[model samples]
Target: MLSIIVAVAENNVIGKDNGLIWKLPRDMKHFKETTTGHYIIMGRKTFESNGRPLPNRTNVIITRDKNYKAEGCVIVHSLEDAIKEAKNDSEAFIIGGGVIYDLSMPLVDRIYLTKIRHTFEGDTLFPELNMDNWNITEKRDFEPDEKNEYPFTILTLDKKK
Candidate 1:
């Protein structure tokens, strides 16, 4: 199953200046726990934002740069090739920069979305998805605390059959 793993603000903002705009340790923990063993596909910018490969997961970066190279990552020119690279994984994750998320939206089977209750100014935005075609199979809400900035909800949505 190809799933999208992302965190978006109320205004659909995901990042600004090539980095995330908020701090949410809880959300980060959740992300790590969920995607640890899976193949993670992301855009070149997303991979750069992270600085290095995430341990314990295969990092596949989709980029148009034919000569792009990340020491520990699999660099592919397109999303289709990224998916093909991880064909053996029963569940691979589409981690992202906005463009990658937008491109993968139609092909992913499920989404693990972290919906922050507040809005923010950002240069990148997650593509708006039509809720009618998805079913929320799992959900959990969290309140802001010392480590997490905003109240948010994490939803696991499965594409309706």
Candidate 2:
């Protein structure tokens, strides 16, 4: 199975200047827990923004640059190649920058989304999802806490049968 994991602001913002706009600890924790031990595929910019490979996960990077290389990651020139490399894993995660998210959205089986209640000014935004195509399999709402600035909801959506 292939899944997409992302946090988006009310305005659909996901990042600004190649970095995430929010610092929600719970969301971060959820991300780590969900993706651990899975094969994670990301675009070159997303991989660079993360600085290094995530521990305990197979990191696959999609980049147009044929010569690009990261010490702890498998670099591929296309999304198809990335998916092919992760085909043997029980589950593979699409962890993104906006472009990557947009490209992989149609191909993924599930989406793990953290929906923040506040709007943010950002250079990058998540693609608009056609909700009719997805069914919410799980949902949890959280109030703002000291460690998290805004109220948010964690939603697990599966492509509708």
lDDT (CA) for every model shown? 0.95, 0.94
Q: Which residue pairs in model 2 clash with each other?
A: none
Worst 10 residues of 2 by lDDT: 15-24
RMSD to the true structure for each prediction, in A, is 0.7, 0.7
Q: Which one is best on lDDT? A: 1
Task: State the lDDT of candidate 1 residue by residue for 61-144, as single tens digits.
Answer: 998899998998899999999999999999999999899999899999999999999999999999999999999999999998
RMSD of 2: 0.7
lDDT of 2 at 22: 84
For model 2, the stretches where C-alpha displacement exceeds 4 angstroms are none
Model 2 residue 83 CA deviation (Å) reads 0.4
Write down the TM-score for model 2.
0.98
TM-score of each: 0.98, 0.98
> Candidate 2's residue-wise lDDT over 1-161, tens digit each?
99999999999999998898788999999999999999999999999999999999999999999899899899999899999999999989999988899999999999999999999999998999999999999999999988988999999999998
lDDT of 2 at 98: 89
